[model samples]
Target chain A: MTSSPEIAMPAADPKDPYAMPALMPSSADRAIRSFDYADFDIPTRKQEDFRYTPVERVEEFFQPFASSDDVTATVGMIDGSALPDTVTVRTASKEETGVPAVGEPADRIEAIEWAAAPSELVIDIRADTPTPVLVDVSGHGLDLAALHIVIVARPHVRADVVIEHTGSARLAEGVEVTAMQGSELSVTSVQEWNDDSKHVGGHRLRIGAEATLRHSVVTLGGDVVRLRMDQDFDGPHAKSDMLGIYFVGAGKHYEHRTMVVHNHPECMSRVIYKGALSGEHAHSTWVGNALIEPTAPGTDSYELNRNLVLTKGAIADSEPNLEIENGNIVGAGHASSVGRFDEEQLFYMESRGVPERQARKLVVHGFFKELVDQVGIPQIDDRIMATLDARLDESVAAPIAEKADDGTANNNENYAHNQEEN
Target chain B: MSTLEIKDLRASVETKEGRKQILNGVNLTIESNTTHAIMGPNGSGKSTLAYTLAGHPKYQVDGGEVLLDGQNLLEMTPDERARAGLFLAMQYPVEVPGVSMTNFLRTAVTAVQGKAPSIRTWTKELSEAMERLRMDPKFAQRSVNEGFSGGEKKRAEVLQLELLRPKFAILDETDSGLDVDALRIVSEGVNRAKENTGMGIMMVTHYTRILKYIKPDVVHVFAHGQVVETGGPELADVLEEEGYDKYLPEGTTESALA
Candidate 1:
């Protein structure tokens, strides 16, 4: 093998344009050599799934790096006491009967090596068993380090994978989850990175016969984060639900792209995503594509993307597409909207004595509750609210609070209705 | 006693043919603890009067002043008017998705009360109010006005009236889209509020159906955007029998009844 370059790129200045950390050669050696980065190049336009999202600009920030000791200390932040004692990484050829079988943890989750020893990962969901697992990945100063994790819900089995990312710097995660025949899976990933962290991750999944898969991503923190999720319903009676929610601030770029396919008859897929952006330069993108194969008779699918832009410079782009080639389909449709808070609704609440902050919070909270409630986890629901509250405080909260000192925030009524419609 | 007074009220709404005046020089006064009925034909601006009083944005008040307890009601926003004890039982309530009835009612109650209602206290109060209306408690969990049948939507309006405890309420055709049973239940709910709170009620309607349940002390005949006649409850009987034709000019079917 050619000697790897050890030169490090300049680290991002905390004050100026948020920059990604440099990558080390060791990390580059781990990725699939056959998969060229340019092959998955984000397009400017005309690209079906990347239509609304600015993935190409985001990709310019990515670099390769090796797993560092920074991850060791970061894992301590996660409460892994409830986690299984033994773990093993199960790939296609490394199948072991007794061990839990998973397609593979995405590279993001697998990158977390324990104490210099490679992580012992295992996907042990057995047929007829219904249980969920939490895989936590934490890091510090890892610079554009990448993590990949793969999960497999065996036939007739059920599982859930909860991924929690807490770290700093530029990080990219790749996750692949597969549900086999008659199986079920729910994967929830939460990115609670700091304002300095930049994250670009992709969730790739496939569901089999009579199987169901649900993927939920809650992004409350991150400077620049882009998420690409692709789901394939491969067997009859299979169903998939993809849901996402994000709150972005000024100078933050949050992009989300989703691609779903109903490849077989009697298969159904639904996608719902909602986001809120505030501050002077907050930008967010939402792209949702649902494809129903011509041979896939009786396919049913629905997709909707809703955005709430809270400020003038805050931008949102939504693109929803449906490719229907079959005549025997039950239904196939898509809806997209990029809007601001509803002013009448806001004034309605405010006139009722809810303060400006509380009123905006209620409207935004209500905006996301529809999709958050779909997760069916009350604890996570509460956690999501708390995270949203904190993020709102982090970006817009400061201005609101600062203005409260001068009693100028009360004039928000003027902007209340003005910002309701984009 | 405090009163809700409309002085020379003139309003119009935008239409394809430009602005059309709906309420022209309308005037009325409602005292606290008394019920007033404004009877009119199909196009007599009855609903427009309610919407104007409630501060709906679509109805522009070209001229007039609305006063609540001698305060300028025209100066307040809709919610502010609501907080100041003016409630409008909308002819068609809006369906707000993702906002549960329980939450909306609780918030409105808190706003009207000018402070947060204790959860425990509000729960008991809500249960009592729902029971009085004979409404299933589960209705509170559904989104406000969403997927509700016409009767259910009307009942929900009355439910808000009870919870909000506004001093003055304009019931805009509360009986318009209800069965006999739903009409009775809704009127009973309003009756209870009147008896318990002594709140002033302004019933605006085309048919005389709801007056039977909640009798009006005074009835005004609305024609050509103005209160052309005012009398005791007997006027409602007279209008019901005459069908507004005797008071209307010939070849003016659109403007006279409207």
Candidate 2:
């Protein structure tokens, strides 16, 4: 095996990627620059990649090249845990750990985020952290915001990091994570924003030989939210798991698009995401794409997406795409489904003396618990579960007819009317 | 003591064919301290009485009134019935994915008892209960009934019945999925609950095999959506010697009674 330095760019695919981002200017690419529209092109639904996305709404919410000067952020240990405090956090410019040394942008929104953030925040972990490091990024009254974060886990070490976005702003950020050889890392991104907030981000995870990475996202807030997760193997025998849980509410949109590129041989990846939607016109979408290159002969990959629609007038879109150039691969498969509450499951719980509202809450919580447990970090897992519980209680913990009584839902009559179908 | 009385109960279930009546003008009563064994062949609507009394939404109450201690049970939700001291050990328990047994048990106990059991006592009780049922300690950590064998699920139902401590429990063919050893272990648990709390039991079974373990105080023979005969425990032996064929009308075939 050649001890080669990391390559930021992947071998361009002829037909697999489907859509590519226009690169930044050579000067801006060399050094992080202020907002620049030259690096991004207007996306239209005519493009297959952009068809499911509400491109026009995203374009109008916040334009590229705008800085978040008024916003503030704070990074600290979670819940005052008595964990090791050796993690080093810093803020710097392009020269820091060779900016853009990680994976490249896979879409136009990512390119815009790269050019908009004023500076980069770099976090270096020399060993496994006893406590999780949290970064709370929030915005005040503002039209747009941008930030950049880089996390590096040294060889044979482990690290856990959580980034929480809150308050109001049209926010865009790019996160770069690199796990060196034999290292393990987990990064959780939670979007708990105000009703007026909107966010877009591209997170790139690169792993060295035999390294492992767990990347999870919990999206529960914001009016319009979209995140792109891109994974690439820098060396052979690397494994990664991408997991997420999202709850979409009324007149809001939350979409997650992912691409896992097996550029090295003997690598494996698994992706599982579950979501629930409530309210009128609330929408959620999951798009998973796994591409296996011909040289990656021992590649094994699978992805699954499932959605539960709680009330009427909600939409859930699930698509799993697999593009493999090598027929010699170990295995490859994908599956997705969007469904309503299971009548049998509900009846089973109700028969046990759990109220209908409480039964729905329990069922929804049960649906997400399997994936939440895989988060691998106890404190973070509990925190996500707490957030999920709060969301469930707020929306699904009551009878639909009661929600209609408050005039919060329009077609809640469908909830009890479906009794005939069940 | 609590008494459960079902009077003139009539119910129908919707199928592809149409809404078919499953329970027709049935009547029965059980004091909290007594046990009743419901013996009926398949399609005799024995299980229907258990589910309808427990408030399954699929079973429309065309006409009926179920009173628990003189309070109308039909007016309450399933959970309310449970809180009011009623439980059902289903023939086939539904598997709830992602919900641990410990969590479900705690929630159910808290809801039924109107308070949470202390952690120390709760842990000790659950562990001891699992041991009595010959279940591995790790089974408590598993998702509720998910991927469990039939015997394991049956044991889980009994486990819940014991912990919840309701006034009455409707065991709908609880013996169907058990081997001899499991049947003995489960029946002993039920007997312990009854002896300790005087929890009335309506044990519904097609065969008299389970009756050998837990003796029934009263036995009722059901046919064609109604009870045709009521007798003491000796009736179980009579039916054991003579199959349900005698209960059918002279001209009618026993195929529907299957």
What is each predicted model's overall lDDT from 0 to 1?
0.71, 0.81
Instruction: Quote the lDDT for A183 in model 1.
Output: 79
**Per-residue lDDT for A1-422 in model 2, tens only?**
45447755544454543344222122112322223445445667886567788887788523457675756667788766533556777887855655345865656777777777777888878888867888888879656777889988888887788888888888888899998899988899989989888888789889889999999988989998999888888899999899989999878899998888888999999888899888778888789888777668788888888887887777887777676666667777776777777666777777666777877878888999888888777877777888878877777644473222232222222111010100
- Give a tens-digit lDDT track for model 2, residues B1-258: 889998999999989999999898889999987889999877889999999988887799999789999999999988898889889999999988877899888888887888889999999999998988889999999988999999999999989988888899999998996899999999999998898899889999898989988889999998878888999999988888777887776765442121
DockQ of candidate 1 compared with the true complex: 0.27
| Number of backbone clashes in candidate 2 | 2
TM-score per candidate? 0.79, 0.87
Task: Identify the runs in model 2 with alpha carbons over 4 angstroms from their true place.
Answer: A1-41, A61-63, A76-90, A94-100, A126-130, A401-422, B248-258
Residue-level lDDT tens digits of model 1 in A85-136: 2222353332333433233322222222111122333354554432346666
Clashes of 1: 27
Error of 2 at A328 (Å): 2.3
Lowest lDDT 10-mer window, candidate 2 chain A?
A413-422
Ten residues in sequence with the least summed lDDT for candidate 2 chain B:
B249-258
